[model samples]
Target: MQDRPTPGQHWPITTWQGWQHFATTPPPTAPQPGEPPRSTEERLAYHSAFVTVRTPAINTLATQVRTLMLLGRHQQTTARPSLIVTGPAAAGKTTALLEVGRTCHLAHTRKHPAPPGLAHQQVPVAYLLVPPGATAKTLATQFARYLGIPTTTRMTQTQITQAVCHTYTTAGVRLVLIDEIHRLNPRTTTGAEAAGLLKDLTERIKATFVYTGIDVAATPLFTGAAPNSPAAPASSPAAPSPPATARPDPSPTSSPTWRTPSTSPTTHPTHSPATPPTSTNAPPAASEASPASSAKQPSPPSATAPNASPRKHSKPSSSTTSPKKQAAPAPANRPKRHDADVKKSADTPNDEDFAALYDRAWDILIFARAGYLDDVSAHYDEVLHEIAQRTEHTGSLGKTDIAALVVWKRLTAQTRWATDLMSLPDTHVRAVTEQAVTAVRDTTLPRSEAARTGRGIIAELPGLRTGDALASAVLTAAAPQRMAVYDRRVQHALDTLGLTLTPAPGRYGRYLQLLDDLLSHGAARADGWSARDIDTALYQMGANPHPAGT
Candidate 1:
């Protein structure tokens, strides 16, 4: 345990020693007014590390984590309450989480000095990222990796989990910090199980957990509330950045490195997205951010130092990199599923709604067909099954197949969509739909990301450009088992059931996650269920929701 990484070697932050270094190491010093980096390497190094901005939001988070840690320490049998920090991407959620971890690590070391030779062995904190398409096994392995536990390919998930819990406990880890919590889509089977695993760990380990992500409150991720263990968790919003302000600099700018700290705040405190009563499932829109560092470069360079002496040409050398960096920040938006907090909160669902539905998820699956428009709806499974076969064999759908789904989806939709898709030339529709189909079925991407990519590509087709109903249908048709259909009806049912599935972009992906969650809760009752099955149930729930007989 006393062993440390070789100097300058890439230390995995997931490991205990790596985290120990991060928690103890200080951020690089910013260039002073008179001291700018002289070379390209210096500029990159300066831009690489995120600036630590101590705003009111991060300070509050620190205090909350500390309080919860102390409270969890005394709890011998109960699951401790945890904290969730949600905000926009690039809005400092990651930065704040790290700062809080650093504070916790140093504070613990000062308060609980190891006695004699046991100094380095008393690990106090652990950190991990919720991976893209995180599974229970992957998550458990991450924990093992953080603690340097040896895991073989032969190890079962249960065995790995048992080892991790035992090791973390033995290490005296009191605080567990997980970043990118938004990646865990509780609606997906794997996401739901991963979420369940986390909840289980909270109960089993005597540690306080702090989760940070983009707008986690607004998505089904908030449905993280479980009855067996812990108290309810609390959330803190990220620091509000002021409007973007810029300063004039005569010096040549670095494409990637920092400019003077822009006086104007580029970001504001992102308010939690509120679900309107009418459209509870309108998920938040989001995009990925560049590196977390805040280095703002100066303006682009002038041509040949523009009418100046030849020697002055070198003065503005930093200008060349400016355009690339400036253009790079162009659209670092948030994800459609990067919602704010727990399912029970926000405008999506109420506790009563969940109590009524989550427990009887099986009833929804088995009985939804009876009340549903069976005459029309039954054709969906048959037709989709055939279409799915085609997609499986060909890797993309043809124009006729695409058109059939558009017609069927619109026909079943409560709100009939009028579109000119039928009139479009087969070649045009075929090209766009195929591109979308391929992106959605991409094996490499997380299903959520794949849905987003596919949606953007498919929206070029008629009718799909405006609403997701047709696009979702096509994507689901592309991979029936892997994807799910979404429309206002499904949204209505989810809202009624106290679940959140917004119509924000990339919603098709989120819809699958929502279905996965039901299947997860359904357990054995939902055996052999597909995301498509959940959509049918949602249709029924939205059509008529209430007590069984009444």
Candidate 2:
């Protein structure tokens, strides 16, 4: 059997829970309805003014990287429609397009790490987010927050759109990166509320758009019936019709058939046996007819001979020759990576796959949580077994360290797995794992202490309970774990870098939680900082950046 990558083995960056949080966050409010829309003339005036001012650098390469920014500016200059980008988180999609803003004369900003060199640019660009829990009205309200437009200004969706369109056109705002795009998938009000609001905003805005979010939610946007597919536009001209005779007729009677006439062959009036009819019709007959034949015989009077019959007309039958080879049809949609893909990747080890193992392990962790374990002892034992297995792998990075981190990351969005990890009946194992997790969380202490603490905690908790049962409780509580998980590879990185932190108290979960909090706090306050900012910063701090930036 092929080796399927365990989801527990590879956890993707964002979790199911993360997506929910994004959708539930409320959007800012908007102005009243029925307000008049800004006039076309007004919008044009703004575009004209900005166009006159001239923008900055144009990325020489200009690949698909800048689709959103180019689109925004195109709309501003040509008065064309706007667009929305939708995709998984940490795809580096936004950064690619944001480069457009970097080069252009117009100013724009990212949510975090701030837009580079904001000091320059003819027109000032500002960044705004589509806050959590936003509806159509609220989304409009948030855009107003940064555009210097007021939510209470009492504008209808259409009117608000016009004013905003006008502002971008006039102000030369070429692009807007709507980070945390998954938030648009709200559970409240049948979900269409958020979808409708986004559709409305795209229609109303003159600026180009860049949407960033989790891969699953973005799947529908890019793959569903939406126009964002990789397919060609529907409006293109179709292949020309073949010749009329080349087509097949539905009616049998209309089908072409070859026919022959019943007329008998004609005989020469007199075959002299010495000569043929050529003699009579030949040049000698020209002696009888042609000194005047130079007169062209009056062009044969433009008429056929009276005795002449219609000649047979036949079309060659359709040939059955083998068909010509054609190029394979291109897929109309983007390719998606699934579990099978992971296995396929593992079989063929490359730098990319090697780097992605940690994430792959995380996925395994999620899949493991489909059931709950009640016996605390069994749970801890299973957890230990898992850790031990991870430690067996050989690579530059220690398998144990990576496994620890993977477990911690997975448990964040799926805690039940850890609490009910295994079916063993040993209470001591649970204690050790818990101790390991706790030790990691208490950043100031050594990991050895945390391991001991976990053991102590388990010792104090009574009973040789199965870890599975506790896992169920953990899942039921929906409590996020506090520890940041670290693996030996991670430890090696820290050690090599000469950092003093020790993994004595907790496992990877402790470290992950701590880092998660710090980054989350940073992102929340930064307003325009994209999820990428947090990821890049953390990876740097760890001194172990994912090859592709994950």
Candidate 3:
């Protein structure tokens, strides 16, 4: 057995090539007697850390999305078609969009000359998350918020919409990415309303829409059908037929049977003794008689002569062998001829059915298909393993400390809160850290009591607001098993499971209850994993559920 790494000790960075290698390298087996087993809290803490890996699917999808944005920028009269990029939780849909956002930002900054009369640089891409159970007004406000435009509760829906359009137009936004689109429950009236709002936005604004969510293909917004309509079929078209000339004839023997060409001595008249055989050692023979005399002389029995004495002459004449020799080469050359014919037939384009077979167009790019999860899960598991390895030497850190770090990382990973948290004063950080510890401790209380306590603690965080992502992150970190972060990714995961979190009165409470029920009654709890593990798993499932055999 090898010596195990000490907990909380920082490993030399030069020893590892990449996070992927660090994650996949197996750790030492269980320690000997007197040594302690790894704690569950440490495992949970490592699993909850934020990491980003760009898989092949993410890169291909990002390239396609960038191409669409470029096309939208060039279009003058045409209404650019909306793009839908959806997958299971943790599929990295948001990460891909963020990459696109970075590209657009870089392009904007690199422009040599500012557009005439523009006070600020034009933003080519506007990326925003769709609020949970978002209404038109809520969505408009979110857009405005992304644009850095002041939004207030006092503003009417129409005013917010107008402001959003005006700001995006002025910024020269060519593309808008609306993430967590699965939250728009098509089963309710709000779903249709949200779809209508998006359609209106595209018609009025110059930007093309890129919507990302979980199993978005199942939703009416992408399927282009009513919620109640028959489900759209899912399949790729059949393989195309070979061209007419390439098609085999109906006759059984149209294609010749494969066989080795004959190399027998009897087939060569000159080589056979009975068929006027020529000797290899002898000099060439010259005809001595004139052509007239040769023709008049009785031609020695032709090799094809049927009545020739079989006892004396056993082999056939050149006349009988010539035709077979010519036919032998035909079979050898047949395939090449057939292929050329097929090519010619394909180029002719005489068949209407063949043209029609390829006329279909694709509007939705469904990322959440079978086998997607396997790729994403392997990538995520590798990341978690790497974190566990790094933190192995830090065993002295208490569960609360690990949990607080997890909360901090997750909260700050959000685009809106990242900068604010980084610039926050030390006193505010300490308060937030204390609140996280308390929140985790309070999970032992009953549901109602815990909710009340959790809400109070969340309200105390310096920069956090009630029902926002930061507050939810703190609460989720404290009691991960019982509470879940109600962010877009979580919502999309729930939607993929055919579940909905209604944003009615007491929406946060209802959301918590829904997650609790899911853990208790849904497949999520079957593995006996902790709430935090389940949350992470579901987020991955929503982001990019691995398909079969991935």
Candidate 4:
């Protein structure tokens, strides 16, 4: 018999069985001559593959949503309180909701065998997306379908609502998540009716409502502004009242140098030039001639005296100028004026308002490639470096270059289409590239015309559809500085910043303009970051389901 081949030997296989055995067996462990065990790149690539970067913003928001869900489950109330998760498009609102739903579902299933005598299984959470332009009837039907209730074409809205309530109560559902609520048009009559139906359900059902949407705060539903109901109070707390004695004198200018006596226990007698002392032996009343003469003698200059004081008070003015000169030198002796100005500006009411909004409304988590490298898995740094090295060979990215990136990234929702696009012939790929270049260069064309050109290119590609993500990706790549990617994530981010884009097919240009405005704003532009970088940050923040610092 032939001697068996050693583990590291590369002996020729003579039979099919030998070939199969060779294929199935693990690779030899022997190291090659002068070869190190594992390179830094290899190790980094390995770590980066498994690392999921989470931000503090995402964690806090998720925790808040989860806590609210749990509270709703155990609370005893006729009208269950609801939560609104509003943020920019693509900022992980749906992801966070789904995560909470999954946790609730798992907890429900773990108690698989209900306590003895409990006839039905409990569904701790129920989730559904609101269809675009959904009406009262459509919403009711959708809710019914989620509850596994059969619906007939003739079923009335009232009937469907009742069925949904009955099913939810029977299933013991404590939380209901409604996503894509931005699709619900409150301007329409049907939309108003649908909102009312949802409100009524909250009162009728024991389940708490958790809504996720892009700029949901702008909607009447979350704004706490029902038709005939009072508007919700502002999120800011009321400013505290000043101490009564510390309040400014009502007529500071009328009484020049009158000193107000302190009411404190440690009070001391005080005097001012404007007020004359009264003694026990002095006359109770002054003669009219004496008052006229006193009035003519110029009273002490008040603190509120005009910048150009009367010539008669020149003596006191000279004394005040000396103090002013002293303060000027003191300012010079102290820190830089600009630094003090910055501090004062930072503490302004406008800054405080922004801070409050950032704390409350801007709760969405943001992720960036650079951020991922900061104390993240050591492998990610190398991975990012590799990506940078590979892309460096490509000339400065233009429309076509960005198109290639989008294609490689597979920005489309349809996996199969992305795969087909990736595997397209070199000629077809070149054709798409040229089309992108032309679209970018044709600035004179109207937005609709440019969009038509983009759509035509998408149509040429097999299995591709003309949607916002695909179209916007092309334009954004073509002009990264002038344009932004218009998808759910971008929309959601804009919404979080208090800018709501109308969801219309013809509003693509408007969306682009709004994104440009945001990037151009003084505060946003102060960091000197590029539009593409900002877009990436927005995408990461919007897409992170699990925030790090919860």
By lDDT, the best candidate is 1
lDDT (CA) per prediction:
0.55, 0.30, 0.41, 0.42
Best candidate, TM-score? 1
Give the clash count for model 4.
16
lDDT tens digits, residues 1-550, model 1?
Answer: 7446678776778888788778777767656888754688877776666556555434555765776676557766434546655555655556666778888888989988767766466688899998886766688889889988998755666788789889888888888888887777544334544665675576567787777777665554554221101111211111111111122233455222111111112232333122101000101112221222221211111231111111111111111000011110111222223233322122444455443455554554455532232212111243454566567666676667865664454343222333366667777776776787788778798666687788888777656776666677788877665677776666655665556565565566666555655655666656545676567556655543221110
Model 4 score (lDDT) = 0.42
Please, what's the RMSD in Å of model 3?
A: 34.0
Candidate 2 residue 317 C-alpha distance from true site, Å: 63
Better of 2 and 4 by lDDT: 4
Per-residue accuracy of model 2 over 115-198 as CA lDDT, tens digit each: 464422223333455567554555656665554565443345545656666765575554454555555432112122344444
Q: Estimate TM-scores for all models.
A: 0.46, 0.26, 0.33, 0.32
Where is the poorest 10-residue window by lDDT in model 4?
A: 320-329
Cα error, residue 493 of model 3, in Å, equals 37
lDDT of 1: 0.55
Instruction: Encode model 3's per-residue lDDT on 1-550: one tens digit a residue.
Output: 0112346654321111121123334433333698666589865554444333433333444455555555556554423444554445654455556555555545554674456655345556666677786655666777777656787655665677788889888867776767787676432223333544564566557876666667665544444343211111111000001101111233665431111112222233122112110000000012232311111111222332111211222221111000011110111111111222222333545544322221110000011211121122111222222223222332122333333443433333344544555566655555654554464456467443464456565554434543434455555544443554455444545454434454443445555554344333323213232344334434434442321100
In the range 201-279, model 4's lDDT, one tens digit per residue, is: 6656777676666765454444333220101111000000110111123465533111212222122223111222110
Instruction: Flag regions of model 3 displaced more than 4 Å.
Output: 1-59, 74-78, 112-120, 227-550
Q: Quick one: ranking by TM-score, best first?
A: 1, 3, 4, 2
Residue 357, model 4: Cα distance from true site in angstroms: 40
